[model samples]
Target: MRIDRRQLLTTLSVTAAFGGLIPVIGQAAGSRDPRLIVIVLRGALDGLTAVPPIGDPDYASLRGDLAVDKAAALPLNDLFGLHPSLVNLARQYHAGQATILHACASPYRDRSHFDGQDVLESGYSVPGHTESGWLNRFLETLPAEQKVGSKGLGIGSTTPLIMRGPADVLGWAPSTLRAADPDLAPRLMDLYTKSDPALASLLDEAIKTGKIASGQTPITAMGGAGDPKTMVAMAEGTARLLTAADGPRVAALAFEGWDTHAREAQRLTQLLTGFDNALGAFETTLGPVWNQTAILVVTEFGRTAAVNGTQGTDHGTATMAFLTGGAVKGGRVIADWPGLKAAQLYQGRDLTPTTDLRAVAKGLMAELYDTSSSALARRVFPDSAGVAPMRGLIV
Candidate 1:
């Protein structure tokens, strides 16, 4: 029995690392045709370490071996410094293209990664809304004229909950696998068109997506999810897709392996370095579009302020959110600056969050999409009416 080559290729694409990243095109709504990308760093990132408060009187002693020395870190301001591994971010910060929201968190308070991520993605006051994500919900609220050809881009084999919803979304992922025979796609597409029109449409879409996914830097060269290089490769591919003249305005990507239960320092060095490089790739790849782009990097929760016995920090509350891209009003670390003193910590353990992350997301949507406060409150992030959208985040 001969197997259909098209089916086999589809199977292979799904099995590959760059399986679900899908790019969608949209018509310009008005003069502002802005772009937004949300990168969810799974495995809660350690905020205190990522952006250390070196000037705080109690930071060094509390962190001990886990502490980032002042000399090693890239100074963000007199009070806080970025992890030394983040060279690209440091460069961007100085160029006024990067902004850090320190001591920020979603409404979720528990430390469980699953629950934390659900709240972070679901845009709910609590967890368990797996049917859709806030970004998808926001897409639903767009005016019909603006959404005519618009679709959300979900980057991964399984679409992250944050991009899953009633709105149409395209999925793709980055892979090192060789492309299928060029002739095979056209022939199979013809066969499907003649007999099964539905299947043909699906194949046509897949072919276009596969073509976009093929030429980007292979994921293998960058290492796995744990390797920082992977982040750069992913960002490069994402940039390529978004820069396409008819490409998507909104994209969602998720990077894993940030849990860091042990060996936090060594691991973070590689991860942050890759993360920093990826940001540079976006700036370079997007060109003038960078001026209209806002990249939001966030995590589930944070880690404890004090280092644990395992040379790492345990899950806690309040980490940080990163907003970078030329579209952002950047170069500042926005924090209410909750001190690192034991008494200052939340429940005597983690950084006490002063800013709700929802406000940050809401703010960007409000400005970029011209989404109203009432709509954002009633629809995009239901039950979040009390949490006003943050302003002055975008240029």
Candidate 2:
């Protein structure tokens, strides 16, 4: 007499079933239809290795064996170079479509991954306050009419906290199984329509999003969400959805498996390669829309300045954030250049953060949505009104 949610899902899988389906309406575009994407790279990224400061005298000595050879790295300028595995990013940089923000971090100073990510995505000065995320809050600040449509999108098995809040958001993840019967979806919809209108309404939206996601590679096909191999597939699917006429204007995605406490050289290579390919997918699939979009790639924190006993770096402070896409004022590395010398290091172990990650995020939001500084400080970032948004980031 009673039906379980899992059973309903299993039966629906015969046609097309989704992980998490939420109703999200679409909005009419104004004169300037700007798109923004936030890609959170989970696990600490070694900022020193990813964007090696080859020009810094202490860089080579401090990094030692983990040092990125300047000759092999893609030169960004006279001082900094991107890791060799970032081939596509390097190309984007050279084409004047990429910019790097070095020595950056969230307000949180502790090293707990769980807490650090919470603070980073939650857009708060401290961790443990997870009722809503900054991006979702930003969506709440949009004009009331904009809320009628697809304002915020979450792509993955579940919505990341960064995209969770009072605002409605569309959720999409490619189906992992083949449809057993093409007719099953409609049949179930009819049954739900008669027996339960609530479920039927949800099913309708699911079917709609499923159609939007049709022809995309499943997460399993690409080796799961956290697997490096899945990056391109995930990115391509995201582009497909974003390119849709009625798709969301802003989106959030998270990639995992970046905590490299050991075997970093080999691991980092694979990760960076996957990331490079994903960047290529976004640039290629977005077409003309790419010119109006900006992608922000960030991590929870950076790793230690020196390599550990296991040839990897430990958790520390101050990492790098990437700003890429045609909308960005590219070909620049923004940093206060905290030297790696012991005296300059944070706690004498990690790179010192000079730029607030929130400032960069706020600046982007300010430009893209024309959000006022007071609104950003009050509703989006919350507290710390003294922090000014970094300028010259957007074209």
After superposition, candidate 2 runs with Cα above 4 Å error = 1-30, 145-151, 176-181, 216-220
What is the alpha-carbon lDDT for the whole of candidate 1?
Answer: 0.82
The lDDT of model 2 is 0.81
CA lDDT, every model vs. true structure? 0.82, 0.81
How large is the C-alpha RMSD of every model relative to the true structure?
Answer: 3.6, 3.4
Q: Estimate the TM-score of every prediction.
A: 0.92, 0.91
Per-residue lDDT for 216-275 in model 1, tens only?
Answer: 323443355545666766677677677776667888988899998899999898788778
Question: Per the 3 Å backbone cut-off, how many clashing residue pairs does candidate 2 have?
Answer: 4
Q: Candidate 2 deviates by what RMSD?
A: 3.4
lDDT digits (tens) for residues 321-365 of candidate 2: 999989898988899998989999999999999999999999998
Which residue pairs in candidate 1 collide? 18-173, 18-174, 20-171, 20-172, 21-171, 21-172, 21-173, 22-170, 22-171, 22-172
